[model samples]
Target chain A: MKEKEINFEEAMKQLENIANELEKGDLSLDESVNKFEEGMKLSKKCNDFLEKAEKKITMLINSDGEIKEEEFKIEEN
Target chain B: MEYNPITVTDLNKYIKEKFDGDEMLANVLVKGEISNFKRHYTGHLYFTLKDENSLIKCVMFKSYTTYLNFIPKDGMKVIILGSVNVFERDGVYQIYAKAMKQDGLGSLYEAYEKLKSKLSQEGLFDVSHKKKIPFMPKTIGVLTSNTGAVIRDIINVSTRRNPNVHIRLYPVPVQGSGAAEKIAKGIEFMNENKFADVLIIGRGGGSLEDLWPFNEEIVARAIYNSEIPIISAVGHETDFTIADFVADLRAPTPSAAAELAVANIDDVKETLRLYNNRYKIALKKRLELMRLSYEKQIARPAFKNPTQKINEQYMLIDMKVKAIQSSIQSKISEEKAKFIKQIARLDTLSPLKTLTRGYSIVTNESGKTIRKVSEIKTGENINLRLVDGEKKAKVL
Candidate 1:
């Protein structure tokens, strides 16, 4: 299966769906195994989202008609 | 007038009467900060209202002070509504306060309540309309002051829970003149750009006046129309704003909002582990059941001893073969007895057999059997055929 770029929210949703399907016990053995594999992939993708992330803060600036992004720093107050 | 000069008491009473006679002085509203506030044992309040240049003594009786929602403290800004009059005995001008409200915040609270009820009646705050916040958001949009503790607190909490979360901050004035418009615009901008999966709009704890922008109708409507679910965390936990009612979710503080937007990575990992185990167990059970059914099917008679079924079919075939053979044999025997009876009857009628019993067959020279003498003619030559031989003789 082709892997696609998915957000953490979407990946979690898919993981939930696969878990429900497996728990229902209506799937064939082959189908159940396929679902297990897909679920594992989604789980890894979601984990990677939290693991590989670097803490970042960005500000949105509206310049003319276009929006620009700039790095923001928090000052000690 | 100088010849009939009155006493000092009369003069003081006249001045007090004049001060009271003025309608403007009778009903006055002043804005200042409280100083030297005191609450007597009788429940009456005595305080001084002062600005930068001057101060004035103010008093609120127990009856009116009982209505005050907050305890008055020195250095707290307030707006007092009452009458300014002079006491004849003390010869001092003082304010007799009827009611008091927080400075610059009284009207804002009124507006907040008004909008809250109006939106509530229109079902904007109905739980049915509120969208569910996603368990894990990729991007968290923030609408708040750019250089404040609100943004920093949200970042700290969210990153601690899940470091991969992306936050896009829209720097907008949290209060003052045009802050409400800018705050609403920030929500619209983020929504139009589809920048985040969920949004957190809020500010740190502040006075009611400082948090007025969140109470504005514009900000409330913006939250109501937001496609991305919004979590409102304006001011402290005690503070409630119009945005809170209209938002999809309400958080007591900016940090709480962050916590709501992201699931803890460790907890999610545990859930994934659980699902993995469940899948394995479910598949194992299914396979076990399938194998059991296979064993049961093979245990049936048809498969357990297949030759038994085949042997039963062979016995039926043998029975049918013997029945057919017996029927054919009986039919052959009946046909043989009938043939013997017919042969015996034929022998009784045969002339050859009669000759052996002393009877003969006579024939004329023409080789015709003679059965009557008239037919043979008296002088006709004839032959007599016995069982053993034939003889020529005269028929007379």
Candidate 2:
């Protein structure tokens, strides 16, 4: 499968499906390696997403009848 | 009226039947403070509901306890909906409570109850209408007061699970007259702009009046119509607002809503690692199997040297050719021996050999051999031939 326009949830689901196919174990050697490469790329993509993720907290503020987003900071207790 | 007097148990049974037949007594709704509240170990609640002027004993069985979100305590004002029934053994009448709710909000409790049943009957709380909450929402829109623990707890819980999750706060009044409209408008805004992947709309625990905004019809309808899934977390665990019933999912508190919104990064990372490892192991196994088949091919003798088999065929052909050549030679020699033996026999039968053996052959001059003397009698002379010399003799 091509990696175009894929999200983390989709990638994760595809990886799991590949894992199940490999476990069933009727595929040829060539097919197995191809699937392995595809699954590996998806796994790597998911890992990169997790590692580079940043939390961006924002709030919706209405000023002069237009709604806009502003950065939100937590009030420390 | 005829009096059929008997035992006290009989009188109690008769009076119990009379109370059971009365429609007013069958469905009684009373508002009073709870006193002598006793929770039996068997899960029945024995209590006395008393106003300043009157009092009534109420017994709520274990089956009815499930509907009571809050535990009844002494002096807590509540409305009990039950029927007047008699305990025959005690010869006294008490109320069997079917449902109860915290009162003192006056008709606000009535409004809350009325809206709950109305929305429920409209199928707004149907499971089919519930939207699926995204497992990994990029942003979580929170609708609550900005000054309290509601927003704080949501932020902390969501970030703790996955630091990548964004919390977008759309602060609105949680109570008072117009709070419900603001809350409903916030839900609409989030859906219209596709603001957040999932919305968390809730506030800290409060009384029925304080949590009244969540129970409003407009807010419940907004939640029901949202394209984006919502997680309603109002008040405490026992609090059940109309929003909770209408939402796609309901969390008991704000922190729980946050937890439901985001997937843990560590766990997801672990899943990725597991897939990577499985890929390596499976690919290695496939490669190893291919290599073993290759090695098996190389180990085959015919595969090692294609000419070896041809060379073996050549050797077999040479052996067959040699056998054919030797068989022909032996046949020729056997024929040659038979020819030689026949030649020797011919030589032994030759007249020269007879002559050498001192045997004489007599014949007329015509070269014909005579076996008897009479055959040559007509001849005037008989020739006698010797091995070394010849002589002529006349016969008398």
Candidate 3:
């Protein structure tokens, strides 16, 4: 069964799904509205997630045992 | 010994019988690496099959060669099924090659080459034809085997990168016969149904044979023709396929492709917040600039010295009135002096001035001063008007 409450990735995926469904002109009005609401929630969640995140740079060892880190400067323009 | 001259047909039949009578020439199975293999101008094959020790010329005419699916190449190991026969003209014994089957290096490499060349010629890998992946895809369609780690990895990476991403798995066969067709159909079906904003068609790393479906002409064409942008993640980074070439975007793995397709919800929200803050800051700065200008305008003399402007106008009006009065006075005095002088001159020359000098105007009766005899009657009453007094007189 598909989860009703979606996580950030799931919500994004659902939002895209909703958009594509709307674009295709397949959904009924009621369904479209529900999908739109879901999409909005997902969009909000995405936005909120981004807003809360700081432009942080850190280093860690990867699965392949290679060390990687954020290397570029954050340009705040 | 008497030898009769044979007819051409008899001689040909006699030579054919002699060739067929060779015991060692019939029912021979020759093993050799194929060389000089050519599909002749007439669709016949002319080739030399040779072992390290010896070589034999061979020919499988067009009628026999038509059944083969793959093109023959040089240095291919094959076992030929044919009888050995002598070419009458060359007098050399050779294999009349028929029914060739691959003995080693199975047809996988041939299949790959065939499909690659076919798809390439059809413009499937044209850069101009590739669709751009959406900036933020909300729904990602995954086409792969459902049971494998491929789908799981895609879901995990997509969800972790952006929890809101919606994934729709369209499970398909990724290998063996009919797999390419199914994968192609999956792409078409998603596009037709509008299942996802972007599609991820991929599988985990595998051998070339395992990855062959992705490299199929059908799959490559389907990916190229897809209306929706596709991300190909068929194998490890080192592994390349026709699907990778034809896809809009190529990822090293299914997880990486998923990561690329969706934007992190947190990142988007943070950007929105930053934009809002910047907007507010800009608006405040604009208002402050307007206020500063307003204050500057208020500090100007026109705003501060309002009564001074009125007072200046009043002073101007007063100065004009005073100047007017003085000029009028001077004009009036000059005129009065001229009038008096004129009056004195007129007193000496004019009758009205003479009257003012103590002479009086006269009229006949009816209040007229008598000046001529015809204006007077014998008995009449007359009144005389003077500068200071009026008198009544009787005229006879």
Q: RMSD in angstroms, all models? A: 8.4, 8.7, 15.3
- lDDT string for model 2 (B267-318, tens) is 8888888988887777777778779989999989988898999999999999
- CAPRI class assigned to model 2: medium
Identify the leading candidate in terms of lDDT: 2
Model 2 misses residue A43 by how many Å? 2.1
Q: Of the candidates numbered 2 and 3, which has the greater DockQ value?
A: 2
Ranking by DockQ: 2, 1, 3
> lDDT for each of the candidates?
0.86, 0.87, 0.74
Winner of 1 and 3 under TM-score: 1
Question: Which candidate, 2 or 3, has the higher lDDT?
Answer: 2
Chain A TM-scores for all candidates read 0.69, 0.77, 0.55
The residue-level lDDT of candidate 2 at A41 comes to 76
Q: What is the lDDT of residue B24 in candidate 2?
A: 98
TM-score of chain B of each: 0.60, 0.67, 0.57
Q: Which 10 residues in a row give candidate 3 chain A its minimum summed lDDT?
A: A54-63
Pick the TM-score winner: 2
User: What DockQ does every candidate get?
Assistant: 0.50, 0.64, 0.05
- Provide the lDDT at B166 for model 3: 62
Q: Which residue segments of model 1 deviate by more than 4 Å? A: A1-18, A30-54, A62-67, B1-32, B35-74, B79-104, B117-129, B311-396
